[model samples]
Target: MSILRHWPSVRARVGRELGLVLALAVVAGGVLGFLALADLVVGGETVAFDTQVLMAFRQAGDAAVPLGAPWLPTVMRDITALGGTAVLSLIVLFTVVYLVLVRRPAAAAFVAGAVLSGAGLSQVLKAFFDRARPDLVPNAPIELSASFPSGHSMLAAVTYLTLGVLLARIETDRRVRVFFPFVAVVLTVLVGVSRVYIGVHWPTDVLGGWLIGAAWAMACWGVVLWLQRGRPALAADG
Candidate 1:
């Protein structure tokens, strides 16, 4: 009877442990992947892959025209805008305000801190790499910044995934927990792909951005979990 009565607690503890382990593993893998890509990119080894991928989206003999339905370019532009600075900033602002209004100050701080730190890290990485935007095709948005690690892709992953994890942690429903993170992943992927499709960022640039951003988000979550381990329940729930 006691065993059965305590089963839910045991299960929850195990789940938390497993989640921590997975987050750490992702951090390790993401760092390694980013470093490997950086080495190749610095050595100019990714030029062929980058050029091929960039050109694949362009119409034959015309770099300006993307190969697809007439409206596809417009769609891509809109999708890319979802990860733009203005949109992401507004999203973070609103989310933080919502969290605060609900009296979840810790959660609000966590979200704001994670996003701001991720943005700073993205800029640092970009400045270090000093990579130029792809010129194989005319850029749709006409971006003018260092482009090794795409700011849009990184910021999207950081913001959406962080929010997803927060939502998942507070929710009790299995399906809802799964749904939030899944949508976050989808949105992150779409933003990254849009950057590449619109010729604003190299494929590797997006890849690097995703790797580092995910690692950062996971690391931040892991720290929060560690900090909240002593409490009876998730701080997020409070």
Candidate 2:
């Protein structure tokens, strides 16, 4: 029997809930991707709200100059560096070590799968959209990929938020469990913004990344819960 169908009603209900969330994410990602594709076909340009996001990205880039707030730019740079290779390596190394140390090999596999999937999806979307990065800023970070949704933002959301969901199982305080992931989410959002501020990404790009990441993360969490359903006494923190 397919696990979803084999599940008892309670587990089935949980699966359905997860299915719903994942469905929504798929719909949202599809819609956003379609809209972006359409925009590109029709001479890609931001609509009003999207334009605002781009403007915000631009202003953020300008403000990051570090004249008055010397450290502000540096801080933003660190966050913005999420797209850089060094940061990516750090994330990879940390995840590998953590999972190995904790003996949660499955957790590591799921996380690696989910993060890599999301990252690949983001790149495919970029190529499909084939949108161009803005020329408004000076010394734009060397990006040659299509700029529809920010890859950094998308990957960040997928990777960090997935970790957050997994972490939720380990911390049962209700408050801590729910809140910490939210903090990760907030930081992910900031990381997206930092990219925009650096003038390396269009605002819409980051927004797309956020939407995609959120949707994918929800879907992964649903799968994990489904797998863990029968064994309520599973490793989750209460």
Candidate 3:
């Protein structure tokens, strides 16, 4: 009798929360993809694609000279800087402050926690993998960190995507919600591509970064959905 009584409410809840299911599915795919890529990286199996992509960005006979106009590298450096630690940190700080000012302490806390933990995760993975940077070309802006899983690419995805989802949740308009996440995806893709073009990271390194970062963001999204499951209005402040 109790089971029969609960079935309708359970079905209703499931119907209303389908987005949560999708988010979880994405999280699963990202994790599995990242792990598979990592395996290939560790087994020395990514050389072909990585080499091909990196070499394609440079001139045929001169690896030091990138294929684009001389000014393009300068623009790429500026774009890549958007994903750097300093820039991302500042963005996170400003966002948290804005949320707090709007009396959204819970949202602020979640953003801070998610970004910090994601950054830590990136560091740990880089150290564990201990992969070397690409030497086929001279790195435009030299890097000192271990190379597999580009930090800039990962952090950009984490911070930008999380911020985008938060903005989407706060807005009630369907178009506005879609727009926020779309911009986030564009920024993330550009940052990852810049990492590859600059010669500081292997193609697989950026790929692994993107996969893990996306997984982390989607996991955060699932948490937000769970929090707002019954009360849609709570999306604005919490």
Candidate 4:
């Protein structure tokens, strides 16, 4: 009788704990995959695959001419701007300010720290790889930085996804929670695809950026979860 009475509560707790474990496992897997990709890229093992993919977006015979409609390049350029420094900075600033206004200084600080650290990490990775930009396309976006991993793609993932996760956590409605992360993912994907479409980054560069950026975001989220779990009393008080 006693076991039966407590079984439901025990099962519920087990289910919740299991879910956390699975989420942690997924984050770990992502980090490992990113590290593997970094190794392969550094070893120059993905050059042929990268070239083939990048060239696919170009004219069949002339690598200089991009494929698709006449206005595609213009559209892609606009999309890529979403991941650029100016726009991302504005978005981050607005998000931080909003969080502060809502009396969530800890959350705001976390967002700022995650994004700034990701940006610095991107730069360090680029310097380490020291890969040159592709010259296959004539009208490629002008860039003067090392280009193994696309910084725009990586930073966009970090900033947008981090913000999404944070916003999702505070939402009481399930639909709104789902919507925030969905929008963040769509933005991240669009930005990465635009980098490739505009011929600024090799396909593998974008892939690497996505991998590392996702890993970094997941890692940060894991840290946040840990902090929250360690402060159940404080959370309850708040």
Alpha-carbon RMSD to native, per candidate:
1.4, 5.7, 4.0, 3.4
Candidate 4 Cα deviation (angstroms), residue 49: 0.9
How many collisions between residues are there in candidate 1?
0
* lDDT score, candidate 1: 0.89
Clashes by residue pair, model 3: none
Residue 149 of candidate 4: its Cα lDDT? 82
Q: Which ten residues in a row have the lowest lDDT in candidate 2?
A: 229-238
lDDT of 1 by residue, 7-93 (tens): 988887787788889889989999999999999999999999999998888888999999899999889889888888899999999
Model 3 error, position 89 (Å): 0.5
For each candidate in the order shown, give its overall lDDT on alpha carbons. 0.89, 0.70, 0.88, 0.82
lDDT score, candidate 4, position 65: 78
* lDDT tens per residue, model 3, 1-238: 9989999777646844886898899899999999999999999999998999998988999888887888999888899999999999999999999889988888898899889999999999999999998877764666899997989989999999999988887787989999999999999999999888888899999989999999998898788778767664334564
Clashing pairs in 2: 149-205, 150-205
- Give the clashing residue pairs of candidate 1, or none: none
Backbone clashes (count) for model 3? 0
lDDT of 2 by residue, 80-198 (tens): 77655468658866986788687767777777788778878888888887777866666657888887777888878777787776776667588898887897788788889888776
What is candidate 1's TM-score against the reference? 0.95
TM-score of 2: 0.76
**Candidate 4 displacement at residue 68 in angstroms:** 1.9
lDDT of 4 by residue, 120-205 (tens): 99999899989999888886768999886899989999999888877776776989989998999999999999888778898888
- Candidates ranked, most accurate by lDDT first: 1, 3, 4, 2
